[model samples]
Target: MNGTGRIQVARKVVGVGSVGTRAWVLLMDTLNGVEPLFLQAKEAQPSVLAEYCGRSQYANQGERVVTGQHLMQAQSDIFLGWTRARGDDGVDRDSYLRQLRDWKFSAPIEQMIPEGMTFYARMCGWTLARAHARSGDRVALAAYLGGSNAFDEAIADFAETYADQNERDYAAFQAAVDDGTAQATTEI
Candidate 1:
């Protein structure tokens, strides 16, 4: 972005859940300020669920994320990549980069109409089924899911229980931090 572009700026991105740091980067051509490219960088860390799911084969945590995205989505962002860099504290970190919005749309859930929410739910189900079909045995999926809502309800129940456990764990961690037994750093 030197002679080709004028200056590149990085803006802090908020609201997104990340294990570590996240930011939005903008690159623009200084000459006309017309050529603009927006990129998102998110820190990658070892997954908390990895212990139960099994060890990842990717050397870098970023690669694990990239691979999972590719497998779960029919189409992935064109500018997806991964890199490692040394932080100011002399610690190496892994991060993944992708276009901020390649072909995406979003709307507040609170603003969605009932009909629209139903349609959206159907679409989400279809997309998840497709992803499972691509990565798992179709015959087995058909057999497991069957022709009823039993499997779906079971999955929902499991998710609720899992979330309750996670909340308990988080509360314990917060108590430790409050008691000065553990330190929680919110900003870097």
Candidate 2:
């Protein structure tokens, strides 16, 4: 941002994954007031796996996000950073900030055919492998995996069980909504 323009900060309440997390967008005009630089800050909380996986070495969840991004990604956002802030509620929260070049993008899974879905699934597998290759101890992982398909089979089994549980959870939520135990709202 440059010149005499002002920055505006707005809360983004919709479409962000995992509802109830605080997300904010900051817009600052560059040069004149026409071109705007967009930065977004999202609340970072402790991992859901913390109970079994222990705690993150980084006390600040924001710093943990930044560090994990740097480790698992080849190229990070230009202004990727982190901070801990005490809000009006007097509670401190860790948040990761990044230049919001794009709001977000996703594949049109609804329109994909079986073949396209297979390809998409393979692509996702490769991407996850790449991230793990970058972050994990490759030698140790190779030693554990060896030249066998046992690890692959075990992983597939776990994934299937996980997906099954997700489906059950979703069904439960739907039942709750239908019975008036939970409320559903539409955006816009």
Candidate 3:
């Protein structure tokens, strides 16, 4: 809210990691409703790694999330911010906000053949490594990893197992739907 604007609507939204969280898409406009900006306000709870990594240093979870994103990304969203609000459950919640969507090119992952897919995977791997390195965890993690391919192999095995689980979960869901135990609709 760097300038004058009015909120148009606040629509509830949810996704994979945000299930049961108070998340919303805030629609707003300025200049007599000619320009519209959609912001996604997602509740920031304790990090999933908190049990193992301990709590974040920042007092506000939203601020911690925003700070981590800033540290991790080379080009973060200009609208990235954080705030506190009273949730529908009458509880105070911290949330991180950012542009709902930003323009950028995405690889044609589905269209890639096996060789292309391998290249894309390596590209993605390097990008993630670069981000982690930039975030100042490079030295400690590198020292812990030492000089071996065991960690790499373990990660690869874990990824394959995770993908296999996802397939099985989707198949079970489809089976449940087919048996009338569950329902699904594509018309969302």
Candidate 4:
């Protein structure tokens, strides 16, 4: 699929209920039904198999926890114009994240995740990368580390889980194929 198509799918996945739901969809696509297994591991054997994972890594590295306050500040700064124009109520992180994720999937490319309070965490890495590449600023390294690339990498890692899920789906379908009782397929 094209980038836009992938983005649409991501948006749809994100819009479902909570962050856990979005993660589940991605996991289902990547790992089959092993989400339960992972969840179990997270609870039972968390330090072993589940270590170095997305949220875990972020928390362990202290990046997310430490920079979280700054991220909020940055987001507020970026969205100052929007807030002024809209006269919207103060931003809450959870609500902002949901709206931002939705906006990312729905907005035109140019308007996608503009630099601001809601997007500060997402943009920090890219901004840092740009600054470092241009001026060799060490401070930018910290920002780059906190940027969207980190989130992108985390999401991409889940593709393995999705692949596992796809394999399971295929296996189930293949069993039907072997049984000679498979339902007739219909095109969309």
Q: Candidate 3, clashing residue pairs?
A: none
On the 0 to 100 scale, the lDDT of residue 37 in model 1 is 71
Instruction: Give per-model TM-scores.
Output: 0.66, 0.74, 0.78, 0.22
Tens-digit lDDT track for model 3 on 49-115? 9999998898889999999999999999999999998876798999999998877677999999999
C-alpha RMSD for every candidate: 6.5, 3.7, 3.2, 18.8
Q: How do the residues 67-174 of candidate 2 rate in per-residue lDDT, one tens digit apiece?
A: 999999878887899999887799999999998664466689999999999999899898888898889898988897899899889989999999999999999999
Best candidate, TM-score: 3
- 46-108 in candidate 4: lDDT tens per residue? 123345553344422223322343443324223211111111355222111212322323334
Candidate 1, residues 67-106: lDDT per residue as tens digits? 8888877888888888887767899888788987777776
Q: Which ten residues in a row have the lowest lDDT in candidate 4?
A: 37-46
The candidate 3 region of ten consecutive residues with least summed lDDT is 1-10
Report lDDT (Cα) of residue 4, candidate 4.
Answer: 21
Residue ranges of candidate 3 with Cα displaced over 4 Å? 1-4, 51-55, 87-90, 164-188
What is the Å distance of residue 153 in model 4 from its true position?
A: 3.0
Worst 10 residues of 1 by lDDT: 19-28
